[model samples]
Target: MPDTAYNLTVGDFNCTVFSDGCLIDPDETFGLNCILIEAEGRKILIDNGFGENSTGTAGLLLDNMKTVGRKPEDIDTIIFDHGHIDHVCGTFKKDGSPVFPNARYIITREEWDYIKSPPGDNETQNGFYRHARQYLLPLHDRFDVVASDCEILSGITLVPAHGHTPGNVMVDLSSQGERLLCIGDIIHSPREFADPACLAAFDVTPAGAIKTRAKILADAARDGTFVFATHFTFPGLGYIRQINGVFSWAPI
Candidate 1:
């Protein structure tokens, strides 16, 4: 199980990246990274993470929360990058009540629609619909809708980057003129930092994902925006740099 959490601060906001755990197989692999942010007098948790129902190696965000002296009840808001199972299952507990009962939830309306009323014959969409039916559907009352590029708070905002899933988005954090973007599942492999067009096999819309990834890389470089890729190596925070016409990730 992942027992450590990475703590860092951006200007005035503090953030902790908690490992829910990882999934590895000969054929496929990925990691689960949930973030807890303390900003502007509010406690916000990003991505509910895989909960108790996940493999034994996961479901430890709450435990990690305690290690950092935070309790589930202390969180006042929860924001999601998308409605994927690994990103949202932790919002509910074994008996189905919300894990952080006091926190208000936010998700893009496109994502809200994708999960609440998934339409299509695609198997992957069907699977996500099933997961949403069990996890997010019951939390409707506490959920709020936001635009693709809406400000979430005084110094935080959500930006659209749809591809990995419909309505997928990234978060923007700014304070004291410093900027960072929590790029949700934008580029899982570091190699993609150099080749922004490469698409993950599971991307629901490969072309859209490619376009978004390219733009994120270009914009981050142009804007000096630090980046936090959800599945990047530990710490995950970094910046994009261009060297000899190729982009590389420079971890901070």
Candidate 2:
């Protein structure tokens, strides 16, 4: 049983992390990490994971939420940093019903457009969206596409971070002087921290990804902001620190 959860407190806000417990050990693959943000009686979900159909080892969102005293319907708001299957598939079920039926879904307009109608025809370019098509397309109307940097609530804001995906964004959070960034796929592996210019194999725009990855890495290092990565490993929580002349991942 890969049911695991971690509690991170930022000031008075609570971010409960749940992992689907599926790790791929080939060339440094990634597992999924989902988060629930609770504050002022509002329950917001970051991303849902690949649902119950991912690699037979995933789909632990619902159960793990239960372990942490949260129910599916308790999710008042659902936000996505991107639309990759591993991150968005759990938003809707095979029957075309939202897992968090009562929660509002948020995505970047650019990401949704790419998922709905990818710009190019390269199989690799759109394959990830294709994998998530069946489940995500049906729930299109449920999405509240964001196009600018705006606060999702009192403390959470969406910051645009293009490159890895057309409209990938970072969930910026601040509460009581503490700052945290849920950087989606900006640096999938800790090794990338040592080489911020490193690009992932699935990078939608190689050049842009390098720049975006490096910028976020530098900012996080300077600000000493705690980051919640969707991949990396279970809990997927860490901070960026500078050592020598390069950066490194200091997992907290």
| Residue-level lDDT tens digits of model 2 in 1-252 | 233888888877888889876747566667679888888899888888888657777887888888767888888888888877778778767665777879888888888888877447666766667755667777677779888486898889999889998888989878999878999788877777666455365688878988998888888888888898888687888888877758887777
Off by over 4 Å in 1: 1-3, 27-29, 194-199
TM-score of 1: 0.91
* lDDT of candidates 1 onward, in order: 0.80, 0.80
Supply every candidate's count of residue pairs whose N, Cα or C atoms clash at under 3 angstroms: 0, 0
Query: What is the lDDT, from 0 to 100, of the residue 65 in candidate 2?
Result: 81
123-197 in candidate 1: lDDT tens per residue?
A: 765665566667677778898988989898888899889987888999888888777789978888776776555
Clashes of 1: 0
Candidate 1, 1: how far from true, in Å? 17
Model 2, residue pairs in steric clash? none
TM-score of each: 0.91, 0.92
